[model samples]
Target: MRKARGCFIFFMIIIVIAAVIIFYFIGSNDRKIASDDSVKINYSEELASYKDNGIDYLFLGIDERENENKFEGRTDTMIIMHIGNNGKNALISIPRDTRVELEGHGINKINAAYVYGGVNMVVDEIYELTDIKIDKVMLANFSAFIKLVDALGGVTITVAEPLHDDKSGSDFDPGTHNFTGEQALAFSRCRATAKGDFDRMDRQKYLLAELFRQKANFSIIPQIPDILKILNEDTKSNFKTFDYIKVAFKMMINRDDFILLTLPGESATIDNVSYVIVDPDEAKIFLNENLG
Candidate 1:
């Protein structure tokens, strides 16, 4: 009986030690993505009046190049992910060249908001434009984008037309292709289409939808650690590790209900600069009709 008790006590101690080690590693990994210097933005007071029936996240794809500060750059892609309580989720893309009035910079492209004041300015501008209160924000650089696509074993997408853009390094004949990280980036960045930036936004939205479908499967469970490591190195988010896990689970369960949309607008040249002129009221109505 004494020997049994001794053995049981030893087993309990071992279990405790293992748990401590597991938690330590988890905390370490969480800290890697949670930078102390992350920018904090306060949503407008008007957002208080808005009822929150679900969670909204703003994802900014920064256009940072090699050897540049990852957090400082023009936002190449702006997407708002709204997860509704009714099991419907939507990914809405906001054009980088959409015109908006900045606090100090007068009227300019929406992407410039990131350059002028980082995530805070961008979030505020988005709120003003759409009146959608964002619950969290995630900023990812080019490195993160490439690595993530690569880690997922690449994504398969169908190209409707031939693309040949020297600037974005895209050269492909029209067909379906399994895109590598670099190729996917180029595809999203290509502006050689007849619609120019609008076409780019459409491609971006399609790519994101494909990524979601691929990632929401159970087969990617083993690759989560590597994926999280890549995100840790190049992505900054206000979400915790558990928060991500929960969202992933939700996405996996609700993958069938996922949808993609882009803000409605027309391209116009104003003051010798091209911009996507989107009406705020129309944008709100569009989101409500589609997202709800």
Candidate 2:
């Protein structure tokens, strides 16, 4: 009788392990980065040194206003976050309209990589431009952003001035307001100011930093089950178990360690098409200084 009971428990464990493997593979649909490529990045020394610190990941927020099994749209927002070992961090925002050569697709705006292919193609384009090796991909639809913010009980933000954007339903006074996930999206998407997309990017980074602050202030462990449930519903990722652990540890160390920055670029008309012509030299300096 004891032998039969032990066998039953072992069999159940195998079933559970199979389920988890399937879950991981479902999101691990892109492995093109490992394929033979001309682009070779030398992050060996840096990665070895930072092994005691944290890791790097590409956080892509696609412009899919709704969530479903099928997600297809431009990646409206792109940010690469590098979590360091000594409570130091760096975040670089890539402009959606930045010009880049999409694999198989002709040269176009960076965001369009998603429309042409998927996460793999986007990674390819980013690597070609930055020469940074992204360890993981967090592909999130706009709907997931809302769900995630709400799951954390909303985040607070200070509006600098009065603004109204009927297109995005973003109307606010010059004061601090606790914003829901949907309102947060609208707030970040508003472009009534003189800076236009640059202003929007700043707002996005501010909200993102606030989210980190709030997550740290309030214990997220108890809310993990609930928050993860919401995350799974609207998002997909290729993050491994240790990756999640490292991210949590980094955030716990110091949420404010994050340094927000953007690529230096100017608007230009190329063949009557608009693009943000990035200064490669400036970008290289920023990448080497911050990433190393």
Candidate 3:
């Protein structure tokens, strides 16, 4: 009887080991590009670098008010967050106005890549500009951003002015305030101020930073289902369920190690049409320093 019990335990251990191996391979396979997808473009393989710091992922917040599935719009926000390996520290936020050249397309506004093609085109554009390969992407719509903020128990924002807008139905005095779905969306999208797009980007970045600040609490775990639902209902990604799980685990583990930088450039008008031009030399130096 003792021998039989020991054998049974040994068999269970073997099964557990096999299960773990299967999980890892299955998860890894899901993240790979599917041959049938139209966006699957040929590119050289990029090896994962096991390092002390972490990896940088291009976080694109697209304004998909038009074609949601095909990922069409001017990427209103582009953030390259370098999430460290241990999941404890991070720097966030990169402005979309940064000028860069897209792969197969000549120099143009950094945000134009999305309008020109889709996530794949934008990914290729960033890869060409930074010379750093991205392992994965999180493609989110503006509405999803609002839902994420609300899922985190709503985000607090400080208003600098009182404004009335019928489109968003918002009018708030200058002070510290908490915002919900539509309010938070309007707050982040506010361009009524004098600074226009620059001010709007700054506000959006600030709001997002605040969200990240509160996301690390243990209490937020229970809200993940709602968050996932928001992502499912509003956002679109190439990742599978397991792939998202693995990435989420990695993020939770190494939430702290992150360095965020925006592409440095200015907006201009060529033949009366606004264009964000890439300052080649300055951009090269910036990429070499930060991305390295």
Candidate 4:
């Protein structure tokens, strides 16, 4: 009995030491990511007021190209990830061409808010449009998206039909396949289908859902450092490293509960400019019903 007790205590000590070492590395990585100069964030009073729900996040995909100013580009994609308290989570896509009135910039595409006032402006516009309060925001450029996808060992997506678009450099035949970073970007950017931008938004939601599902698994633990490095270099967000870690755990545990939604709207040509017209009341109702 004495020898068995001694062995048990020795194993417990080893387990405790291993846990401490793991936590130390996680904390170090978090601090390194937070210390990056480019990841600085300034919170506005309005944004602060909307912090009722701690799990809501707004993710923006910027269209900036290589050598261009990343901070000034129009948002190519906008998504709200709402993690409900009841174990229900949702990925809601807002079309970039959705029509909205900017405070000082008159009526324009919703994507323009990013150019006028960055992520804060986009948050305000979304609130104005859907009455949904965003708790945090993440902005990633094309490079970030590509690198992050590749880092995750790519995502699997199914193309319903053959899609060919020269503008976005996307050409995929109908089938299911694992896509590289470049192919994923092209798939998300291609809007040459019958529904145009709406189809693109659907693809974005699907791709993101798949990415989250893959990333939440235990197999990706060895790649966390590379993933964090990519995020630190190419992404800007109000999320701390711990916040990301918690989100990943939540996603892994509740992967089956995740659902995808797109803001309801119709395409219209107004004054020769194309736009997606969404009714505010209807949008709120739709979200309220589905988000829970």
The number of the candidate with the highest TM-score is: 1
Please, what are the lDDT tens digits per residue for candidate 3 over residues 16-94?
7655655654454354435226334334454233232455556677777766553567887776655544543334344
On the 0 to 100 scale, the lDDT of residue 18 in model 3 is 51
Question: What are the per-residue Cα lDDT tens digits for candidate 4 across 145-234?
Answer: 889989899989999978899999899999998999999999999999999998999999888887877777877765666677777667
Looking at model 3, which ten-residue stretch has the lowest summed lDDT?
43-52
TM-score, ranked from best to worst: 1, 4, 2, 3
Worst 10 residues of 2 by lDDT: 32-41
Give the Cα lDDT of each candidate: 0.82, 0.73, 0.63, 0.81
Q: Which has the greatest lDDT?
A: 1
- Kindly give the number of clashing pairs for every candidate: 0, 1, 16, 0
The residue-by-residue lDDT of candidate 2 on 25-123, one tens digit each, is 334423322441311233445443443235568888877753343356778889988776555587778888898877677789998987786666676
RMSD of each: 5.9, 8.1, 8.0, 4.9
Deviation from native of the Cα of residue 8 in model 4, angstroms: 18
Pairs of residues clashing in candidate 4: none
TM-score of each: 0.87, 0.78, 0.70, 0.85
Look at candidate 2 and give me any clashing residue pairs.
Answer: 53-85
| Cα error of candidate 1 at position 15, Å | 17
Which stretches of model 3 miss by more than 4 angstroms? 1-53, 68-70, 84-107, 160-170, 240-260, 287-292
